[model samples]
Target: MSVTAAEVLIDTLHDWGVDRIFGMPGDGINGIMEALRFRQDRIQFIQVRHEEAAAFMACAHAKYTGQLGVCLATSGPGGLHLLNGLYDAKLDGQPVLAITGMPFHDLIGTKTQQDVELDKVFMDVAVYNERVMGAAHIENIAHLACRTALSYRGVAHITFPVDLQDSEVSKPTTKRNVPNHTSDVFAIEAGFPSNRDLDLAAAVLNGGEKVVILAGRGALGASEELELLAERLGAPIVKALLGKGSVPDDSPYTTGTIGLLGTKPSQEVLEECDTLLIAGSSFPYIEFLPKPGQARGVQIDMDPMRIGLRYPIEVGLVGQCRKTLNALLPMVQQKEDRSFLEKTQKGMKVWWALMEARGTNQSTPMKPQVVAWELGKQLRNSAIVSSDSGTIATWWARQVPAKADQLHSVSGNLASMANGLPYAMAAQLAYPDRQCVAFVGDGGFSMLMAELATCVKYQLPVKVIIIKNNTLGMIKWEQMVFLGNPEYGCELHPINFALFAEACGAKGLTIDDPQHCAATLQEAFETPGPVIIEALVDPFEPPMPPKVTLDQAAKFAHSLAKGEPNRDKIALTVLSDKVRELI
Candidate 1:
């Protein structure tokens, strides 16, 4: 007697330390799902309404736990739906394994039902892509894909053909051999930064009138080292949104985030700095970048390819930031440019104060920041907060302080909308003892609202805060920025989210008054099961605080200040004092 391929795969997943999988069932994947059902106690298969939501859930699980997240999909469209969220995981360098269904090997070339090339569609976004053609290839391919996903720290795909899924295969008693990457292209000296690279970077810093530091997603892993580097150099640090909390905004060297939606200081520092040390981020906006040829740009990245991708580099050092920065710190000389760093830090402080002090008690519609900040204060230190892609995500990342025990997970690289609720459910389920909440926009909430049933069924305590503005806030803002007047098609109809949550077997509440936000949140948190609190937020809510580019403001004014245009009709005038003062 021989074990089936599906059973062997599930047993292997259990051995790989996977406690659960998020996926949807389909005819193509019936065999695999059935296998998963047999081990419901050892490895649970969490069925989600949409494959997109399932992928997002796996991403959150990986981010919170620092492990590989797994999601399954049926053939054709079901497999395709996983790409958007899987792309997010890949860009962020998260370890995610997407097991997708495909037509049997024989029918692949014939273009049978859902017979698209799954591996080909996924190759661009994943670290590795492989299809199991024969039962003999299962054990080796599965282990290889897993190792590749972990090694590259990104998404990997292993397509299981329907024909091969039920076929019997012998399981290896020991873990199979996994491939290793030994690229000389990325190799670095064993000791530290070469004397030459340090000499060049140090000379630039010593000679420059002002020095600034720009950190990106790559900086996430070496946050403490970055802080030390900033402190030693007395350079102001501005993180990309993805690099939120790389260092406390209050740190002496901190200067908030930089980009189109970035703070005034971040914009000003790039303009003023004679030397800019780029750390761990390939920030894409070329217009926001400083003069690469004349201005000194020193980059530190583990992947050599990313060093000079976005901007011209004066010194490109390939190594882990933590290790390389530690080695470079001693060899480099300190700068005495406290004036620039001081000015930038002071600007950030005043910006935050003005933003927070405004309309803490407005009578009309409540400020969005006020709601987010107040919720921030009420959240326990151990709570984990997830934000969907939108203005709300930016607000939470900026205003909500993540303490030692607290974790803040955002879809950075993929930066897609509607990930909040899915991430919230997964985070809460992963750490049931800790509180979990998702701050989502009206548009984002609806994207994954169907997952409410999954949360309720599992008895996972999670809270969802929906800013019901009834329109795509960020897109509306973009229209105001790029296009001259207000645009059509951005507006959306309002949803009775409270009714929807109740229908899904979870507690739901609606709050129109700003005064009751804290209390409403408290009651929701106290509820034993999942809860959704929909706040009919002001349509005229201010944009996320800090990091508004001068060009964006200028473009907006150029379009609107001419007259009370029709575009302004759709715009909400209930601006937050916090936002106005900061910009």
Candidate 2:
């Protein structure tokens, strides 16, 4: 009997070294789902509750492993649910392949049920988007999608009609697999910048007196080279959020994250630097970057389009991050004056002191900063931490100290909520032996709370720490800063997250008192199965920016006058802390 196209597609995926796929079964995808069942030993199918979680899991899998992550969904709404997670993959530059099953080819355009245009929907997010029209095209299309996703480091999508999936084909024509199991169609090499471009970049670095290095996700592979570059240039390094683990937070020359979710020391470094060296990061926030004419910049990126995109660049060197940095290091002159680096390091120490004071607060409703600080301290060097976006991100970015060997991931460019749980689930699935933890806010976690069952079903043993403030903490802060409005519609009715976890067959604990915060977290970490620690944090504790501008103060004051809850307590404590610095 001739093999079906669906079987051939699965075979191609297996040949390309794909171990697992995340998705749900549906009528539209029954053929492919059955094929997956038949090939259970070769490839595992992780059934998620929602298609969104499936895509999120796949995106996280790609991010954690640096390989092509695959996800599947049925037609119409199922495929639509994948947009947000697929967008996350696209923006973060992760290689992910999304396979969606569409309606029968004949009924696609007849206003049939579940007949959405998959190609049109996925075109923007995918580097390669195609629909398999014939049975023979399955292997070729599958191979191309995988290759495109891996080589380009972005999303590739293939939509298969349900009827065509089971269509039989004889002797599918494709390239022969080599002895090493790599396909001839997918072999590629890394590209680097020209020698002239490297020399120019080195010259720019050597000529500047106050140099600051901005590292991004692209620098993850070149930690040693990055350290050497910073040492030689006497430069202070400020990491972008995605670059959290690119360098150890304990490094003398390293300042914390720089942006809205950044530290004062990093902001200071950005303000004072005369020359900026950006490696492997295209952080989109221009407001956080130096103004025009503030600094001469040299950007190192593999994509020429992203170089000098956020800042004005004097030199843009297009090359692989590790290779480019290695080449530039030898040509660059070592700085004689280490004053700037020393000053930044001193400022970093003061910032750490301030954070320590905040993290140890003994307020009635526990401060969220303490959770991040305690968790960071307790995390092993081999631990993998996934943080959700919003107010929770501020704590992780500021308080959590990431080591070189440890891994950290957040929703970077997309900055979407509800990713923490899925990210943690995928990380745990990928590295079952490693300690995995997720820091998620109440609002964000509620968005995908159903996935808790996904964790328990697999017995992933992922530790979930929910900062339950019963409010959209980040949005409330934003309203105060931008609209001068008392937070409206941001409040959430408190739910017993601990009880919810227990209902899902997981151990749950609640830490409302500051005294037991540390002990409770330690217990949760030690639990053998999936655990959820619901820390009822103080909602009034705002995620203040590194520098509070005059306009921000005015808006905050207006918000207070408009009867923001806990105004007196928040103003007296947080505002007073800011005022003491002025004195």
Best by TM-score: 2
**Local error of candidate 2 at 141, Å?**
0.7
lDDT string, candidate 1, 319-361, tens digits: 7677777777775566655777788778878767754664355
TM-score of candidate 2 against the unseen true structure: 0.96
Candidate 1 global CA lDDT score = 0.77
Candidate 1 colliding pairs, count: 6
- Regions of candidate 1 where Cα sits further than 4 Å from its true position: 171-209, 359-361, 544-583
Cα shift from native, residue 60, model 2 (Å) = 0.9
| Steric clash pairs (candidate 2) | none
lDDT of 2 by residue, 338-450 (tens): 99999998998899988887777676778898888889888989999999999999999998899878999999999999999999999999999999998999999999999
The local lDDT score (0 to 100) that residue 283 gets in candidate 1 is 77
Off-target runs (Cα >4 Å) in candidate 2 are 171-184, 576-583
Q: What lDDT score belongs to each candidate, Candidate 1 first?
A: 0.77, 0.90
Q: At residue 101, give the lDDT of candidate 1.
A: 90
Error of 1 at 492 (Å): 1.0
